[model samples]
Target: DEVFTGDERWRGLPVPAGDRFAWEPESTYIRRAPYFDGMPKTPEPIADIRAGRVLCLLGDSITTDHISPAGSIRKTSPAGQYLVAHAVQPVDFNSYGSRRGNHEVMVRGTFANVRLKNLLAPGTEGPVTVHLPDGEQMTIYDASVKYLREGVPLIVIAGQEYGSGSSRDWAAKGPRLLGVRAVIAQSYERIHRSNLVGMGILPLQFLANDTPASLGLSGKESFDIVGLADVLAEGFPRGKDVEVKATRPDGSGVRFKANVRIDTPQELQYYRHGGILEYVLRQLRDAGR
Candidate 1:
């Protein structure tokens, strides 16, 4: 084996002490993630998603590209605004994929593909959604912020082949950061479904030829996912049935049973810990103790 020489270009950079990392406090490309912020040694029990609002209603064949943080950051997009607020120039603004380490940018970039159409905002495209009850239309990130302010969990309603594309981690991570608690779709791309579970998002699949159109879900309802509390309390089982109730503005409701997509025991553990990252952290912490 040949002895390797260090690159001369970065030879003079100050190195961090011991095993510590030199985290930049103001770097746009790589900021600390909040996934483990205030993470307890033990994870709290996962709860049933109650009174969750539909963040968007999407049609079939929605790809990971439609959901992931990718492409160039627009000067007017939420991610761009964030960068501008942090004093980054428009000319210097990079692509969302290049800034994935910053949850703030990535979350704002979620569902923001210019070509992505949201049924909630018909005749329009990009990251736009109508916030529930008040029915105010705004950017998805803005609406999510308002929903989060009021402690409302968000869900996505979609048709067949949802998340069908390359396995992009930001596709799940962005939604999780945006407060998306669950996704009810006719189907899912296999890896994306697992990635959703890894991010602590519940992926529920429609049962028996059921579709959002058939269910009369107008994306205007407040939803309640029943049986999860009980199931998760005991122990999460693969393919458990959960009841989803969508209450419309008129107080009428559409109810249906959906199959929980946590398909394996290992995935169950990932969800129980609120995510795989948390599970690994807890394991390492416990092992050291």
Candidate 2:
């Protein structure tokens, strides 16, 4: 009893008291998320995706680890550069899992597995992609930055079992932050599909046994997800069939149908409101009225 009573090491620690906890701006471990930044009381209407560029073309069995790596951060990676710029040494740069609270790091770590093979940048491995309309080869994070700067939406094309490994939330959150508006894949791991919707990313599945290879999608064409504007106007019909048109530089295009992957009515509601966070915020704001 004396030994237990004598422990006063933490008694003098400071305790913060406030209605809203102040986030430390200088701390890299946990930063304020920008998910609700500029969020309006009501969501704008969801529109069709036009002229979307393929960010990466991946093969089958791509795991959540491939989408959001949790291992040691490379000194040359975008996430590493961010930390270094903030005066953190390479030795202090921790694994991605350890820094998950920081969106800046996690977003850069998306699709950054050292073993990942993005077919868009052939013969190269690990977080590399080719920016469209210029054929400029750069890191996936860099290309995403360029694409976002140019006001272009991004998409990822993949074969079967996409997001097949551990159910990591960052797998979905990271892609959404990288300006990836949609993912068209042969199949998706169940939880990852839900996560995608939870992050306000449209998940589409190819129809009629269609594959990107069968459709001759070279990953360089400009894609338009047709019927989304109409579907959103008509209330985002569940599992609606939508046409995808991939137009090449020559102006010729291939069209195919894909099924929306929003499975439940609640998921549809979340997607319509631009994600669960936004939906819940509006709900709370309106409830007081």
Candidate 3:
């Protein structure tokens, strides 16, 4: 099956030199992404996600595909429309899997699945939510934009097997880009949970007996996750629990315990400084010194 020998060369062709790659600035595969602009600051080793808006209150069996979809981008969808508007023809609007290098596309494609049923937009499906304090329904990205402008963080409340299936990276990256600070679920597919930690998103598990339904989450409440920072400070131990206090519009509240799922020293470091990439970067930076 070899098309040619290793020594084969076309005449008059310029050779690529050196061990370093010559990165093309206009190439679709950008070696560096604008999505991750600044070096991640020294995160406060704190995991306290307080009073954030609920982007979605979902039910069980939520797969990675739902969190960050694959396959063809629908022509009218956010990612597709963005490509078209930028002069990429509808025919050239390829699968999200192929557009991974572009954070703008992937972030827009984050929850843009056709079958996603976010409880916030009852009886409707796909990547939509209600941005509150104003209660306007919009695309999840747009809602996250408004929330970001308002200096608000975001959270997703969900049922069991929250991130089941293939550990697609964007399933975590997309939400984090949308400013999702935490995800409290009945249980997590182990790999996906780790991926969340890798992306610096706190993944909390409800005690085996408690489900989102049992907590009476309506996708309308504001939440404050307490004790994360204290737990981390006390030495990142296994089986530690944090409390989630959810407040309704009427000022009523519900409090419950969730297992802090960070089971390793490395995972703790990753979570502390916002994610694995930042943790590694910091380590390399320090080591070089």
Candidate 4:
């Protein structure tokens, strides 16, 4: 039998020569190795949630059923029209619940709810009309895609009781996939808010009596969420204020404050690790030893 000497650091760690062992390799070796060879070398972490640079709000009491409906289709709604236009096979255009795994389908299906009247693209009397950069009338999802393609940051502003329905992971995953970086609402429903955090979507709350309308927020404005990393790091300890800088269409800006939804150290760790899924996977792998 042949024997290969393991690294000196693994001398008595019970690791066999051919088996895996934790070795602190030089930076060059790690960076140039086969597993990481194609990885982008950047000063910042690779899985940072803040990298998406967009924010999209979940409206008040947005149920998982709302995020991705679980019923028959009409063939004329946004999801239906998009599917047909894209040449998707009729049989393949299943319910939103079934297609949640695919970003393409979910992004197209977003904001497709029957009651969802896109304030930006309101069909009738409304507070404002959202104009796509192309000067065309389209659904909010289309506009979101345009913004995402333009590399502009997004943040969703919403009213009270946001995300108030069933516990659906896809509800959170969908927004993250859509390039939403944060969600600032007047209030949050317990499970949905945690789900947002689990999917790496920051959830912030307005102070008492503050709301999207109260702050004169419209879907048209751009927003910047400051002190996000710190808020996540500190687990959003009570009294910590999250500042939001909103840039209006005319280029003027106003600042508002929100309360971070993170309430515990475990949650902070989850956020730091880029959500609960990654955190759980890491734990599983570690325990297998």
Top lDDT hit: 2
Clashing residue pairs for model 2: none
Off by over 4 Å in 2: 1-11, 233-236
- lDDT digits (tens) for residues 99-118 of candidate 2: 99999999999999999999
Q: What ordering of candidates by TM-score runs from best to worst?
A: 1, 2, 3, 4
Clashes of each: 0, 0, 0, 9
Better of 2 and 3 by lDDT: 2
lDDT of 4 by residue, 191-217 (tens): 888888787667788989787777877
Cα RMSD of all models vs. native, in order, equals: 1.7, 2.5, 2.9, 11.2
Estimated TM-score for each candidate: 0.95, 0.95, 0.90, 0.70
Query: Candidate 3, 155: how far from true, in Å?
Result: 0.6
Query: Model 4: clashing residue pairs?
Result: 53-153, 54-154, 54-181, 55-154, 55-155, 55-156, 56-156, 57-156, 120-130
Q: Can you write out model 1's per-residue Cα lDDT over 1-289, one digit (the tens) per residue? A: 3245457756766777778667888888888889998887788977788999999899999999999847899999999999999999999987988888888899899999999899999988899999888988899999999999999999999998999988899999999999999999999999999999999999999997799999999999999999997876667567678899999999999999999999988999999899999999899888998
What is the lDDT, from 0 to 100, of the residue 232 in candidate 1?
68
**What's the TM for model 4?**
0.70
- CA error at residue 129 for candidate 1, angstroms: 0.5
Q: Show pairs that collide, candidate 1.
A: none
Q: Mind giving the per-residue lDDT tens digits that candidate 3 earns over 61-93? A: 999999888799888888888777777887887
lDDT values for all models: 0.91, 0.92, 0.84, 0.60
